[model samples]
Target chain A: MAEEAAVGCARPTGGPVGEENQNETLQSQETLKEERSMIKVGQKAPDFIAPGYHKGAFVNVKLSDYLGKWVLLCFYPGDFTFV
Target chain B: MSIDSMFVHKMWNDHELEHMVKGGIPYPMLSDAGGKVGTVYGVYDENAGVEARGRFIIDPDGVVQGYEVLTPPVGRNVNETFRQLQAFQLVRETKGGEATPSGWRPGKKTLKPGINLVGKVWKEWKTTDAFD
Candidate 1:
């Protein structure tokens, strides 16, 4: 819609452009924030017992195995060059 | 190249593994072959055949102390991860008595609220204050 385009252009940073836009933007942002807030701080992390290829062998790595150590569980979009 | 073949060989090839090791990637890069982990984490993009870039700082007790999930287009900052670790470390050292604000750095002033305290802590903060 032209109105949406105007709003998009007016707010290049994707924030609310006007009073009318504020309500819609806030709603949309809240939905997104909720979806992104899946994991919470100081909560028990989801455990997993999965096979990981380490040193050319399939090894079973479990969340419980790394107990008492800070674990940085990272998920990357694919392995190769596509970021 | 096909996704299956990419997963079979190129995903965890020696050269890539060596490069990651040399680059000082401390943690193991686990492959989410069947997208199960990614699916559970809500980062799996089925059409893309990959998970969205995300990071979780799990504490020693297996609890997720901090979590950050960025959109694919916006890459994560590695240094920020270290900063988060340091912040968490500081908080642990100080017990559950204090919390760091945005852009808070280690060895910097921390907030300790009292009954009489009002407004932002930084506004009345003094350089010579004991908490600083």
Candidate 2:
């Protein structure tokens, strides 16, 4: 998913970090696996806090931050992988 | 949102900035590598390990008003998305007094949604209307 998301929008940062980063990402995925659920229309969308890339900087953004404004939650596969 | 890390996003932006003289990614691309965000939106293909392209329009009250998920092979049109947004806003502002017809644009005539409008849209909207 990470690779696919990358390809949908921006290219990958560099070549590859190493084993440590891979393990870390996998670990996070494992932790989130249990929380997956089907979100429904008219239901309250889940709130999330994640790092976002904007204007060449990494900013910590949260879904709650856009409370009063309409939000277009777009999800892509990876940064640089094939779409 | 994407599954790539912030580091990768930064790199992508840097590359785009260097190469593309005009226009960059306008919105903040959230990183959901853990797949948490995708899971919530139900766009994550757990086995395929990728999120099918998904677009959700959330109202100010945090409700999911509209959404669509397409296969990864296809891309979405930004102009259409913006048009949809405007339609939603227009309807909301009018307090359901009017509704945008198909191919509706800003400043165009809008239909008055009601039981009578179900089949008489063509008659209600004249040929001169932009939707026609």
Candidate 3:
């Protein structure tokens, strides 16, 4: 786990630390609202690097890394939930 | 992708990981506990506190070729996603000259798009033949 964290410490989306400031994050949600419209067909997908679970290890994944292949970004709720 | 932690995802998919052909899950199941990807994709329902079922098919250039977001109750069809991918790949290979018709599959007829084909698509396309 320590080694995994060391490899891909680059958190582009500020995900892991986002929960620290909920109030501030909520205020920033206003700016994020405008981003909703940008995610659409024919538009370039937003690039992100996040910790992904594969083969029992936490690995960083970048959307750009899959540039030459078809990428299926399937977003569901948390695992073991209703989804 | 889900908002679950990497640990949780590992625990959840343990069976598939251990027994799968490659000894791992077929694809990368991203952990978006912060809902970052969900927010960008507009699939996060902040009030409900969960991400809606969302699927995005991105082409080689990273452009979103097809996407769908459904309410939580509805699941997705992998076959349909694959079909769309194939259709987009075919059109991309042909450089917009060919288009897949309704329910079109590979080895099936494709429609040739042009000013002349605008109104005659229905009459020109058949399962065995393509528009001239």
Candidate 4:
């Protein structure tokens, strides 16, 4: 647990998001809201890097890392909740 | 991805998911805490602090091609997602010259997109073929 925390600590929460919203992060919360509107098909997906469980281990899931492959971003409510 | 922590995902994969699959889910189950990723996708329920069940299919170019969001109690389907992925790959390979019919599966007949093909798909492909 401590090791995992140390590994994840290197990357700040929403690190990639903050990088993507460089200008907005520097501004007020309103700017962040304005910048992060709904993402529609035919538009580029907002890139993100989040902590994830994969292959029986913890890892950073970078959306860009899966480029060149078909990606299905399956989002469900919290696990163990019938999903 | 939902707002679940990595610890919860680990537990689920090891305890519950392993029973269904040989080694649980094959893909990465992301932990998007605080619904940050969900908010961008418009599936976040701020009050709930979790994402509604959603599936976004993205192509190789990182462009979202399809998505669906349903509340809990209505689980999503992996088969449907895989079918769409295959369809998308086929369409991409053909450069939109070919289209997959409803319930299309690999090795199934594909329709060529053109004015002549319009209203004539039935002549080439029957509704029953969707199952075959």
Candidate 5:
């Protein structure tokens, strides 16, 4: 569980660190830190109404539709691994 | 977790859906194709046209209870969601009777209510008399 929590916490901070040299590491670290600070806990999740390809057709789904259920909204960098 | 070509292709494919369904992903995995959800979630990369790996547990009331936004390399744990859900359920059901500590499990010890009971509760954890 601790490992899992560490994985969660490390998600936002584990950008290119070891691969880079000292100078590049410092620059990348500052940029990543700035990006992380943008998302704060306790803030309202931004709502959206968009075309979702669920079941078969591209149905319009809105954030408001999930008002009564626990929505695990996750975002991956790309379809594969370029992050 | 990479979310690059392979990840995106897998997620958007029928095989991946079947795999996730078999793997017991109870919740829906909505795609942020245009990066709208990702942008709103603050995980969107404009240059790459993709979202950063991010996870948020939004309660029934639409408030975010747990939020985790990771860089691209790491994967998320499905168990933490269950743990959080359990913790939230326990607190909601029990009202203010107890509070969950870090890494709290369902049947494990919880902090008891009261003023003077604080020190005593911590000290008398081994004793059954600590709980009211």
Candidate 6:
């Protein structure tokens, strides 16, 4: 299910993510191994405090600090990987 | 977020991302030590010791509105993320009085979801309208 969510919007343009219309992308993309992440919609996003790198300095950013604003939290496989 | 430390993020930001985005990423690149943050989001791969590629769109009220998780080979679209953020904001600003149709962009036709709009969406919005 997460793989389906991942592949649909990964397309460059003209397609909304999570739409089942992208049958071609569904087939062309390899089936990924089962995942364990169980994040659900409409739930409170998990909060965390961590050290971050920004513009040549280390800063502490707390998830709660960004309250009252749209937060786009992105995760990737370590550093130096293609975004 | 990933398990990368602050120093690694610094190197990547200075050497790679800045070259790609002119002034580097305009947002903070967080260091998720031990994959703690990723684990809470369920994007952490214990065996791999890294977080899977994932993005969560959290609204101003701190609710998770949208999210995507992908593997390493596939790259997520930044433009699409922006589009979604704008769409979400528009819907919120309108206080749910307006809804964005699929593939909706700013200034495009927005649907006012209601009992009357339950089944007649095709009349108010057309496939061709999305392109206009």
TM-scores vs. true structure, each candidate: 0.67, 0.74, 0.77, 0.76, 0.64, 0.79
- Residues A1-83 of candidate 2 have per-residue lDDT tens digits of 44543333323244345566777789888866776656888788888899888876778898888989999988876765454
- The better candidate by DockQ, 2 or 4, is 2
The global Cα lDDT (0 to 1) of model 6 is: 0.81
lDDT of 4 by residue, B2-98 (tens): 6879898888889999999897889888898888789888887664566778889999999999988888767677788888888989999999999
TM-score of chain B of 5: 0.69
Per-residue CA lDDT of candidate 6, range B62-132, in tens? Answer: 89999998887788999889998999999899999999997688878889999999889989887786663
Give the alpha carbon lDDT tens digit for every residue of B3-110 in model 5. Answer: 233333334545555554664333334555656556556777755555666778777777777777766677777787788778876776788577777657678787
Better of 1 and 5 by DockQ: 5
> Which tens-of-lDDT digit does each residue in B1-132 have in candidate 1?
111223343345565666757633334446567666666666665545656677889888888888787656567888889888988877777785676666667767666656555666757465455332
Candidate 5, TM-score vs. the true structure? 0.64
Ranking by lDDT: 6, 4, 2, 3, 1, 5
Against the native chain B, what TM-score does each candidate's chain B reach? 0.71, 0.82, 0.85, 0.84, 0.69, 0.90
Per-residue error (Å), model 2, residue A63: 0.8
Give the higher-TM-score candidate: 2 or 5: 2
Better of 1 and 6 by DockQ: 6
Who is ahead in TM-score, 2 or 4? 4
Q: DockQ of candidates 1 onward, in order?
A: 0.23, 0.42, 0.35, 0.34, 0.29, 0.33
* Stretches of candidate 1 exceeding 4 Å from the true structure: A1-37, A55-57, B1-13, B20-26, B123-132
Between candidates 3 and 6, the lDDT winner: 6
Question: Model 3 off-target regions past 4 Å?
Answer: A1-38, B15-24, B126-132
Clash count of each predicted structure: 0, 13, 0, 1, 15, 2
Best-fitting candidate, measured by lDDT? 6
Docking class of 4: acceptable
User: Could you give candidate 3's per-residue lDDT for residues B1-132 as a string of tens digits?
Assistant: 877788877887885445545665778888887677788888876555567788999999999998988776567888888888899999999999999987787778788989988889769765455332
